[model samples]
Target chain A: MSLVRLCLIMLALLALAAAVAILLGETPLSLGQYLQALTHPASPPGEVLWTIRAPRVAMAILVGGALGLAGATMQGLLRNPLADPGVLGVSAISGLGAALAIAGGLAAVPGAIELSALAGALVAGGAVVAIALRLREPEALILFGVAISAFGGALTALVFNLAPSPVAIAEILAWLMGSVENRDWTDSLRAIVPMAVGAALCLKAGRGLRMLTLGEEAARMSGLPMPRLRAYAVAGAALLTGAAVAGAGVIGFVGLAAPHMVRALVKDDPRRILWPSALAGALLLVVADLAARLAPTDQELKLGVVTALFGAPVFALLAWRAARSWRS
Target chain B: MTAAWTLNGVSARLNGKRALDAADLVAWPGEVVGVVGPNGAGKTSLLRAGLGLLPLTSGEARLSGQRLDQLTAAQRAGLVGYLPQDRRVAWNLPAEVVAGLGAIDLPEVQALILARDRLASVGAGDLATRGVLDMSGGERARVLLARLLCARAPLLVADEPIAGLDPDAQLLTLDLLRAEAARGAAVVVTLHDLSLAARCCDRVIVLDQGRVAAEGVPGVALASDVLARVFKLDGALVESPAGPVLAARRL
Candidate 1:
C-alpha cells in the first residue's frame, strides 16, 4: 500500500476508537451528545467532552505517537529489531521521578508530578547526549541505558517501601499503572512541543540510518555525519519518551509493539516505516485506553495493563516471524 | 592527467599491529587498478586509509589535490564509491533499497529509479525486488556491485570483488569493473586470484608484508622472480589466447 493510504487507514481506526472512548464513560454519554459537544460549549455534553474525554484521548495520541516514533528510531539506529524506547531507561527513570513526587505529597499540585518525571528523564537524557556525542560505538549507549535503568528500578522499589501513607501509596501506584484520567489541555500542550520537535529531528536522521545498513565503515565512507545522526536518534528518542512519561505517567507496550506491527504492512525502510508506525501506535494506544475504560471489574483497568495484555501476543508473533531469518 | 586519489607514504595500524607500512598508491580515471597480496599484506588497510575511512598514523592521503581531512562528506561521496571487504547488508531491505542507499541525498523515488537502472546494468535486474538475505552468495555480490554502480562516482574502490564467485560470474564482475573504467571512473579492487588480476587489471600492485613489493603492468609486476619472492610461486605471467594469465604453482 502507498504510505498515505496506510496512514489514512490508521487515522480512521483511531477516529473509531476515539468515538468509543468518548461515548463509553461512567456517565454514559451518547453519540448525539458527543457530536453536539464538538460545538456547543454551554451544553452538559460539552463539559464532559471538552474538559474530560477530549484531553484524555488527545493524551493517548500524543503519547502513543511519541513512543512509536522513538521506537522506530532506536530500532533503526541500533539495527536491532527488538529495540524500543524503554530500552534506554527513560521510562523507568521518569517513573522513579513521578513516584518520588507522589511520596512527597506533590500529586495534589497541578503539575508537580509531571515536572518531577521530566526532571528525572532529563538526567537520563543528559547522559545520552554526552555519550552519543563523545563515543564512537552505539553499543556504549545501550550498555549505559541498561546500567541506569537498573539503578532507577532499584531506587523506585525503595521509594515504594518508604511511602508515608496508604493513600500516598495508592496514588503513586495509580500513576505508575499509567492513566489519562483528569489530564487536561495544558498537559496535552506541554507534551506536544517536545513530541513535535523530537519527531522532526528523528525523521531527519533517516539518511544516516539508511547508510548504516551498509555497516559502520561503509556508512562513514558515504560522508554521513555519524556523530550528529547518533545524537539526533538518542536525543529525539529521549525527548519523545520524556514527553509521554511527563504527561500520562508510564504507559507501556505501545512503543514496543507499534513498529513491529507496521513492519508487516510496509517495507522495512527505517525512514519509510516511521510514519506508519507512529499512526499504528496512536491507534494502538487509543484502542487500548478504550479497553481500559470498559473492562468488567470493580475498579477501572490501567491503560498500561490493557496494552500489555493486548500487545504481548501481537509482538511475540512479529518477533517469531523475524526469528526465521536467523535460522535460514 | 592528475590522479583521482593518492595515498602518499601512508602507515596505519589495526588492532595494534601495522596493517599498511609506508604505502604509496594512486589511480587515474579510465584505468582498472588491482591490489594483490597474502592475507596479512594490508591491501584492505591501504584502500581504507586512502579513502579517509581509517586514520593515518603518519603521512597524508589526498583526493583531487585536497587533503582528506579537508574534504566534506558530500565531496567524498561525489569523489569515491567504496565496497568494504565484508559485504554486510544489516537488514533484509529490498535489493532496490540497498542500491538506492548509494545516493541518499536524492528523493526516495528518484534514488530507487536510479538504483533500478544500475541493477539492470549489472545484469541482476530481476534481483531488485527480492530481499538480499534470501539471495545466494553470487546474487548478493551482484546486488552489492549494482549498489556501487549506483553511485556513479568518479572513483570506485571494492575489496575482493570476485573472491567467492564462480568462473563465469568472475569474468562478468571483471568486465563490469572494466566497463566502469571505460566510462572514465577510476576503479580500484583487491583480488586474491593473481590470474584474474593478470587477465583483467590495466595495472596491478603486489603487496607483501604491508609494503608495496612491486607495481606496474601485470606482465612486469607478476614476472617470475617477484612472484617467487612475494607469493612463493614458481611461475611467470604468460600470454594465453584470451589474455595475460599468471601461470604458477606453489613453490
Candidate 2:
C-alpha cells in the first residue's frame, strides 16, 4: 500500500518539477511544446529544456528528497515531531559555511561552497550530539540546540556583514533564503551521492530505531548497542542535512514538517513510513518550489518563504490537534 | 534440580548510594521466588543488577555457571526474561505486535505454544488485537505477563509485576508464573502484595534498607519477627480460601 503511494507521489513530484522548469520561466511552453522540447535534441529548445530546466528540476528533487528523509529520520531518532535540521542548527551552520566560502572568494574555485556547507553541517550536528550527550534530559538537548542555532545564526550574520561587495551579500542572502534557480547538473551530483548514502544508512539503522523507541534499557536488553546506534542515526542525519544544505542554501520545513505529516498519515509505524516520508518530503519541496516560481509577482519569492508560509500553519494545526488529543 | 542462578556477594551502587549491599542468593531451576520489601528497599536494584541491566559496584552474578555480563543479549535473552516496573509502551501498537516482540527467536511451534497456552494461561487470549494503551490496567498487566511468559526463558525477573492489577488478574498472573516455574524456569518477582507472595511463591526474600532482612519459605520468612520489626507492621497470618495468607496491619 505504502509502496504504491510512494511511487505515485514520486511520479507526481517529477511531473511538478518538469512543470516548474518548463512553464515558470520567461518563455512559457505548452505541454505539447514541452514534450517537443524534451524530445527534439537537435533543436534549440532541447538545450534550453535539458540544460537549464532539467538540472534545476533534478536539483529540486534531490534537495527536496534529502531534506524530507533527513527530517523524518531526525524526528524518529529524537522522538520529537517538530525536529528538523533547520531548527536544530543544521541549516544555520550550512549557511555559515556557504557565507564563508562566498565571503572569502572561494566559490570562484567551484564546489567550495558545497564543501564548506557540508563541513558546517557536520560541525553543527556533532555539536548537537555532544551537547545532547552532556545533558541528562532530552528537553535539555533541544534547548541547547536552540542556543547553538542562535550562535550559528549570529556567526552567519557576522560573515555576511564582512563581505567585501554588495554582489556577494546579495548572492549569500539569496542562497540563505534558498532557491533551485540557476543550478546545474554538477551541483545536483554534488548533493545526490552524499544524500543517497546517508538515507541508505538511516534505512539500515531503522530497525535499531524501533528497538530504541522502546526506551534505552529495553533497546539494550534487545541486543542493541545504544551508543553506536545513536551515533549512526546522528551521523546519517548530519550527512543528509549537509548534502541538502550544500545543494540548496537551506530549505526549511521539509525536514521538520515532512516526517510529522507522514507519521500523522501513516500512524507511526517507523518501518513502513520511511519511504512515504522521503517521497512526501520530495513532493512538498517540489510543490513549494513550483509555487515559488509561479507566484504572480514581478520578482520570485524565496522557496523557504513559500514552504515556511505553507508549512507553519499546517504544522500549527497539527500541533494543536496533537495537544488536544494528548489532553483527551 | 539445578541452580538456575547464583549471586556471590553481589553489591550495587547508584550515584554513590549503596542500593544493594553484599547480597547472596541461589535460585534453583523450576522454583518461584518472591521478593517483598518496603519502598526504596533496593528490591528492583537487586533484580536489575542480577539481570546485568545495571552495573555492579562489587561482586558478581552467574546464570547457570556463565558470568552474567559474558552472555550476549540474545544468548542471555534465551536464559532470562525481565519485565521492569511501569513499562511505558506506545499503546498504538496492537497486543499481538507487542506479544510478537517476545517471540523473537523461538521456532514457529514454540511461538504457537506461547500464543495458545500462555495467552490462555494469563487470561489474555481475547486481547490479542487490542491496543495496549487502550486496555484496562488489569488487561495490560495480563498481556505484559503473557509477553514475559512467551520469552520461554529459564529465569524470569519481574519488578512489581502485579501492581495496579485487579485481584482476579493478579491471581491469574501468579498462577501463570507458577506454571512457568513448573516448566523449569526460575521465576523471581518483586511484589507488594504479601498475600499473593505467601500463596504463590515457594520461597520469599524480604529486603530492608538495601540488605536482605530475611529469606526462606514464605510462611517462615513472613512470620519472622525481624520482618515485622523492619516493615513496622503488626504482622499476622490469615487462613484464606487460596491458602495461608500474610496480613500485615499497621503498627
Indicate the DockQ of the complex predicted as candidate 2: 0.36
lDDT of 1 by residue, B1-251 (tens): 87888989999998789888899888999999999988889999899899987789998998867788898887888889999887767677899999888886788899999999989988889899998877988988898888888887889999998988888889999999999999899999999999889889999999998899999998888889999999998998778898877778899
- lDDT of each residue in B1-251, candidate 2, tens digit only: 55788877889987689999988778888899998889999888888888887799889998877998899877787777778785665324556555655666765456655665666667777777666667776777777677777777788888898888778777877887888899888999999888888889999998888888889998788884855677888867688776987766677
lDDT of 2 at B208: 88
Backbone clashes in model 1, listed as residue pairs: none
Stretches of candidate 1 exceeding 4 Å from the true structure: A30-45, A88-90, A97-151, A158-172, A224-226, B105-110, B223-251
Per-candidate DockQ values are 0.63, 0.36
Report model 2's interface C-alpha RMSD after superposition on the true interface residues: 2.5
Candidate 1 chain A, run of 10 with poorest lDDT: A131-140
Candidate 2 clashing pairs, residues 3+ apart or interchain: none
Which candidate tops DockQ?
1
